[model samples]
Target chain A: MKKYSDRDSLLIFIVLIFFFILFIKLMYLQIILHVKIDRVVKKMVTKNNIENSKRGDILDIKGNILATSVKQYIIFLDSKIIKDLNKIKMILFKYGIKIKEQKITEFKEKSYIPIAYNVNIDIANKIRSQKLEGVGFDVRYTRHHPEGKFLTHILGITDCCGNGLEGIEKKYNKYLLGSKIVTRMYRDGYGHIIMQDKLVDQSKMCGQNVILSIDRNIQFIAEQELRKAFDKYNAKKAICIIQNPKNGGILAMVSLPDFDFSNRIKNLKILRNSAISDVYEPGSTFKIVTIAAALDMGKIKCSDSFYLENGKLKLGGHIIRDNHKINGTVSLSKIMEISSNIGIIKIAQKLVKKEFYDYIKKFGFHSLTGIDLIGESKGILMNLKYWNHLTLPTISFGQGIAVTPIQMLSAFSIIANDGVFKKPYVVQEIRKVNNKITFNILDNQKLGKRVVSYETAQIIKKLLRNVVESGTGKNAKVNGYSVAGKTGTAQKFDHKTKSYSTKFYTVSFCGMLPVINPKLVILVIIDEPKSNNYYAAAVAAPVFANIAKRTAEYLGIKKDKYEIV
Target chain B: MYKYFLLIILIILSIFIYLWQQNTSIRFAYKVSNLQTKYNKISIENDLLKLKINSLLALEKMYSIADRNGLMRPDGNNVVYLN
Candidate 1:
């Protein structure tokens, strides 16, 4: 009996050892293979919870929000998991959403179903509260331009996906879309967060804010005057750019026939910013380069007299006529004051072709002005090899070459900045979304490159002042400001006749107020006005005067030319 | 008996620590999530107010309002400047 009991005990011991090994193997699978198996199971039940981070804001120098992002929601359908389709449809109907039966069946298997986006929080929360199966909620941010149509061309617009398609918005898109993250959360068959990662700073995902050098008051004044001229003249296009000549800061820039950011674009032509993209003949305003070059090189003197050819000079089978007729020889300064094209062309004839070409390029023409905006055009200048006998004479009077208004403004800015060329920029600082200014223009202290001798710039300024005070630019003078500027009226090129058209003209005026220690440099262009008066003096000068006057008053600029009673 | 007593104490302490850590992490997560919700609300409010301010300061809107109110520009004779 004892032997029989021992045999039974041995069998029982072997069975016990087998059970113990099985238990150890099960524990190993649960602990060691846990993460790998959990991921696979989680894929079936887990969904990514994305935090729709806000895009950065764009503000004026004074921290006035021009462009911002608002919190919104995106409601998507999950037809696969939907329990009560009719009930879900009824709940979403009040929030401007409808799910067609056929459409739901068509995408019945799809886990991710998009229904409506940009829904406000109040409505979104109401829909989310129903907690109906298959209905999902996602946070989204919508871009807002608070100033409406103002600064449209500068602020630009975004695509449906919130990507900046144009202007400053497009330029700083990367910085604005900061660190939007998608996190994994596990839930049961019913959508609920079982386990989730830690909450992060949602604001950190927002893009950095861009602060522009544009002044709201100054931009308003410029836009108001430019719009008035644009409407009154029935002009095809109008552009006005205001710059801080001391530091190459663009204060105000307006291009008319402009589209509103709030409205969908119907015509693509309105998207083109004429100030930096469209090229036009600079007319007599380009004479500054000729005079400055000659004076700088000691090739032409201020007192040097030139025969005016009795107001007309025949060159290369083309007659170049001066609008203001002057008899006999006139001093160089008188030639500039009268804007005698023939006299200036005669002076240009004295310099070598290469020297004249060198000076034209030296004045920031036929090249990008390096402004912060994109799609800048390098104005047309024919290579010296392509320059015919007439090219030099026409170019001397600003007829043959084409130049962008921003480039023209920068050239004038060089003179105002005491012959130093500082690159023009619209962005003044980059800040955090919370209005903390990070990168500042004032802190940069960028040194400017010398473009001309100070003596030459002073001479040109004096001549420009004479033009405004006693010459064609007299209309551009302010009541208590000593302004200096040049007037230009260049005929538009007609492709049909292959010659300059008489009917259409681009009248422009580039100038600055408080000539000595100048505060602002302004450029105004009116393209193809239908009015009887198409002269730069008549069409563009008055606009400059009004904008400068209002801007000076708003900025409280000192009146440097006041007379004592 | 002494060894068995030590083992029981160690196991209980370990289990207690594990439960405490899980409880603390989950509790702090809820707090963080609540704060995030409040922050998002404030940010939305800030943006909406800015939009309102911008509309009020809009140049065209202001001009139209001024015109409607029968405002007149001061003449040169009436205008004064502060030095």
Candidate 2:
């Protein structure tokens, strides 16, 4: 080595020191702060994107779309990235979206400004094709009811976030809401996103579809006829329910004063399904229960005669009078034919109070019908211990008791179904998005309990048929079909006066088509009819006859009544 | 010397294969992404069409149309049984 002076040696030492310092800095960066830097870079390059699936549909029995979810877009703007505001405005205007001056001003301060909502895919696609910078779209689903006001009470409504809020939507929400999937994506240098895996099949992740037992045609027919009567009488409320007595499937149910669900609901009270939620004194409809019980329990026979105290009798410090006066004793069938209140009261006296109450429970009164619906009432039934002498007699005439329209329909169905009580249901099946049936009503069908003997049921059917043939239900006669049913006109009880209102009455008719082997059970109730005539025979019976005639023609039930040429 | 040379060639080939696979995977990812977007657009169009069909065929709408056209429901006596 060559010997150097002091200056040269100092230069060499400084150079070596500089190299050592550089090495230390490199080591510190690669080890000590490595994890922090790596984490920051990863967060910038990778994204967690949440993918939303569409909600399922609700269909009628014949696979008609009753309710569905359509994919809509929320057109938003990234204020930070948006430039050329006029150009964006021009592009949006081409798609018929007029952004107000105030809204355009709002776009500057907010990072994300939602310009429009519920934008159709076609319009959204047109705007997106313009390739305007700083414009983004957020996908959303909006519920749609295609049938307008038909089945409003059953289809229900949903919230803005696509959650079911009422009716069938609320009862089967979990099965109707689809899954939300989170996926990991990588961002390239050009800002293009690269998915880590193949895109998921959206239909597989979608919610299960619900199918109801309601027939749209039958519903339409019932709605049309019931609405005519409702408007004609200017009734406060009207309800109609048609059921298949064999399977307990509700074919059609309509409640009047229905609102269009597509519009904003101002009066939420109308949302209550009066057919299942609201209760009324069933009036003469409950008489069927008493007559069936008496016939079944051997307390009275079809041939047994009861004296109708000259159409009036004093009982429990109250006077019970019949609509028709019959002084002498008449057969059980004749008593029901004339709908004699004193006749039914005399018949009810034969059974013990405990026995009558037991029969009522067995008929599914004072208990939830176990219908797959929301807000079902078991009706107002006093317990055995609370029963006064008036309770038994009043309940016998359908006075002191209350029942929902569905309960009354079901009670009559017991007679039509050969005295077997089957639980009424609207939801027929639950199917996957792939059309694979996951739940069927038949699979979960409960074996009907026997409420009366088959013979007793046959006798009641004949008696009901006689009522429609030549008695109070004569107005309910259909041309080609044999109708077996009863008429009820119950006076409304005034709470303030503690007496029955002379002006207000609930007129109803519950009947079955084809007396023997009944296929359809229909019940119609017109509450507080404001028309000149409010009798069950005049108001409710005519409506029932019209519905039965049209429904029978549409269903093509063979004509049981033949006219001799 | 020959065995060492063969080992080096094998390592080089393995690295080439690995690089080829990575490139193909990225290309496939891009293709899949494009296809997914097309599928979403088509499905949206299909849903809209289905909704349109249902709305047009609604019973109330059909009834009104019939009424406007003066088409009445056939009476029971006029209809003959087919079966």
Question: Among the candidates, what TM-score does chain A have in each?
Answer: 0.88, 0.92
Per-prediction TM-score, please?
Answer: 0.87, 0.92
What does DockQ give for each predicted structure?
0.45, 0.63
How well is each residue in A246-312 modelled by candidate 2, as lDDT tens digits?
9999999999889897678999998999999999998877888898888888988788888898988
Best by the lDDT measure? 2
- Report residue A461 deviation for candidate 2 (angstroms): 0.8
Residue-wise lDDT of candidate 1 within B1-83, one digit each (tens)? 99999999999999999999988876765566566667767777776776778878876788788899999655333556765
Q: Per-residue lDDT of A24-137 in model 1, one digit per residue for the tens? A: 888888998889888888787677776656778888888788888887777888767888878888878877798677766777689878788777777877777877788888
In order, the Cα lDDT scores of the candidates are 0.85, 0.89
Give the poorly placed runs of model 2, Cα more than 4 Å off: A1-27, A77-93, A100-115, A131-135, A563-565, B1-20
Q: What's the TM for chain B in candidate 1?
A: 0.76
